[model samples]
Target: MKYVIKTQECGYLFKNGILKKILFAGKYRILSMSGWELKITEMTGKVDTKGLPTELLMEQPDFVSRVVRVQIPDDCIGFHLVNGVYKQVIMEGEALYWNVFEKNEIRLVNVTGTEMTEAQVPAMYRHLIPSRLYKRLSVGEGETGLLYIDGRFEKQLSSGTYFYWIYAHEVSMKLYSLKVQQLEISGQEILTSDKVGVRLNILCSYRITRPLELVQKTDNVANLLYTRIQLLAREYIGGFRLDELLAQKEEIGRFLMKQIQGVQEEYCVEILNTGIKDIILPGEIRDIMNTVLVAEKKAQANVIMRREEVASTRSLLNTAKLMEENKVLYRLKELEYLERICDRVGSISLNGAGSVLEQLAALALPKG
Candidate 1:
């Protein structure tokens, strides 16, 4: 029998259904009575020995020279790199690849540590790793991530990406927004000093100063601050009459801020600002306040009108006195009046007039 193996492939020579020898690219002649057969395999794939001993195949120097053998330890994984490029992940075991065509190599990685940073496995290669082997966490911008290992807090991580080996232990992450945040405590019903019921809507802006201390102080920071503010608002508002509250609304905010100073220090948070957003009055109280405001405005208008009338009367009296004391001033004033009448009337009838001007002056003068 005769056989030919291509340059890119090798042939597994079998004799009587048993492996005998490995043949590289070439031509060979054998006895037809030997009942020999050949199986062709690609050189780019793993070496298949057909149940033949690997050592037996290695005994052939021709086979050993053209293949690369890999042995992975139990505590380590392997990355297969062909021609300096990543091809696939190699598990913990023995494997063989044909090295006749392309350069074959393996890079080993230790799995003893729980975390695999970018230094260990660059971000470019992270996608190639199996999803089951690692757990990923991404902390977005304006957020702080807390890493926990086995139900215990480990360390704070700023905004970035992280990966942990899941086979090592249980890993978890909690993220909190670090930017200024607002909390609305709305629709709170409380009684004022005068026993007037009102609904208050309060708003507060806060930021986390020391996240570690905050977590130690309370499991839930938002709920704690909300309850504290609510109680303080009720306590402070209860001491002021409804009228006083409406008058000094800003004062209430300052009082609440002062009261929560201790809480802020203990909880490790900075209260930037707080204020009463809205003070919703009862229907009856609202109607009464509207009526009072209208009455006050009307009284102010009436006072202004009376003052103007008094000033006008006094001026008239003073002008009359000046005219009575000086006849020349009185005649000038009469002429001014006559000029105004002439502008309104086109013509005037004169009766027994010494002169037109004298008659016109008499007609323009007021009767005593």
Candidate 2:
């Protein structure tokens, strides 16, 4: 016979064939069951056993007059209720969700009704996923749908290719709110880690297509651009002294800009402005350069000093020659000697002085 069981907990009606003892009698054991068939009497009311078979009265529901409670601590664990049966199913962690959905067999609730190629899936869903998941999806465009790798996007990705996406709710599949393009390299990709400890230099110019204000404060786009340029510059002009770049500033700048442009088609970083940011020179090499510059300056100073000395000597020689060629100069020299001798002599002794004066005059005359 059917029995009407009422309780303050959930009210649920069970058929005789489906009812089974989930817990031992006499103990308030919380039972976990599955595959129990049931119908919703009132969508807004609690669960109760009002029209269930007598055998179904063995257990009490959690709530009888309240709404169904489906609270999950973590969204990573999915939950659903069908036919009064509660089910818990684990989903891809935040990181793997994008890649999980890219697989043909996996399905996402909001991702249906849109056409995508293998290459476009990661790019399309990257922003929709959490940052951790966003980074894990290696998305690339492909024929069937967007191709996604667990971590690396794909093989043979060229430089200058961009991936575009938006939050799922921001726009219909028709438009993308976040558009990221990839820059492809014509040649093979070179790994920087492979060349660690190698001396290098870089120079580059970049321009922002969008307003600078739009970029995040922590993005460090300028610094990153500079670093990449420096890497490329080092690849071409490695081992060059810092002073050498200073000397050949124009040439180095041009070479760096050219190399940056070559990689521009691959990296997708804008080249709004370009320049050499820094030139790293080995400490020993820089000291040597400083020494050479100092030596050069000293040599220049010596040359200047020698020229001034030579000019002074020439002027003195010319003055002496002009004085010897003129009779007025001879008189002046005799007068200068007489003034000095007269000052030293107390009385005039013309008798012997005349002879001394003649000898002095002969001695003072310029040689032929």
Candidate 3:
């Protein structure tokens, strides 16, 4: 007898119900014998006992083969379990050859039919997982998230769970603080128009008017507001001299609002109230101003003293005129003088006087 086999397949020959040598692709010759049997098996693409008859792969481990080739379904994934424990995740396109023996069994399950997320999958299997398959965003009450796709602003999202299917587009979200916020523009050196350098500190309190614009219009709203404050303050200060700006610190802040009043509107930021916290002048300037103030006060004191002295002299002149015109007026003036003298003397010894009261009254008069 003669047999021929194709190059793509291997042939195994058995005679008289006993195993024989394996045959590769070619022609084989056998001599005719009594009670002779020839069994041929074809090994395509890969040779395995799985394609062979069931009797060939029975419980006999010595002669039986449990090695099999399995290719995970294109639409399914393989969760490799060993000893009933999760081993590793097998990608959809991955094909593996598993030899099941004793207690192990290899199987494939449909991934599309199951409710699972990429996050649930182990990190070691991330590279094989799809990006946009799971939702990554969720917003709660009193909060908002800004959605951006492919680095472009899409829209605003309110409180709720948000999902994105990451296919070809990149997804990202930015959360904003909606509660009232206080920003401090701490000590910033600003120069006045007259070339006097001063440090100005300001405080600004605000809340978000439009959450979408607040996030999309600027990279950092707080930073932008800070920059705006500095620029506006410098511009306002540059237009005024030192003395005026120092005197009207609050008023200068008003001008800051007037020049760029609605500037924050561009970014959807609302300005509640902006006020100057403090103004600091240079040491030399402060000392010089203090000296000038003290000198002006001293000058005022001197003027007041001279005015009082002149009024006292004029009153004395008027009193003298009255005395010269009337004897009664002169006597009254003398009596007034005597009373003052009596108040100063605790006890008195008068040489000629009608009474102690008379002595005391006459003490202030001239001897003549």
Best by lDDT: 1
Q: Which of candidates 1 and 3 is the stronger one according to lDDT?
A: 1
Cα lDDT of model 1 by residue, 1-368, tens digit: 77788899887787887767878789988664778888878787688776777888888888899999989987777888889887788867887888878888878877667789776777888787778778999999988988898889989999988888876678998787888999889999999989999999999898888887777777788898899999999888999999999999998888887777667888788898889999999999999999999999999999999999999999999999999999889889878877888899988887874855688767779999
Alpha-carbon local distance difference test for all models: 0.85, 0.41, 0.66
> Which residue pairs clash in candidate 1?
none
Off by over 4 Å in 3: 1-180, 319-333, 344-346, 349-368
Candidate 2 deviant stretches above 4 angstroms: 1-205, 210-227, 239-246, 262-272, 329-368
- Lowest lDDT sum, 10 consecutive residues, model 3, at 94-103
TM-score, per-candidate, Cα-based: 0.82, 0.33, 0.47
Pick out the ten consecutive residues of candidate 2 with the lowest summed lDDT: 95-104
Q: Which pairs of residues clash in candidate 3, taking residues 3 or more apart in a chain or in different chains?
A: 132-166
Clashes of each: 0, 51, 1
Q: What is the Å distance of residue 212 in model 1 from its true position?
A: 1.7
Question: Which stretches of candidate 1 lie above 4 Å from their native place?
Answer: 50-55, 307-368
Q: Tell me the tens digit of each residue's lDDT in model 3 across 76-121.
A: 5566555655555565553333233323334565544322344545
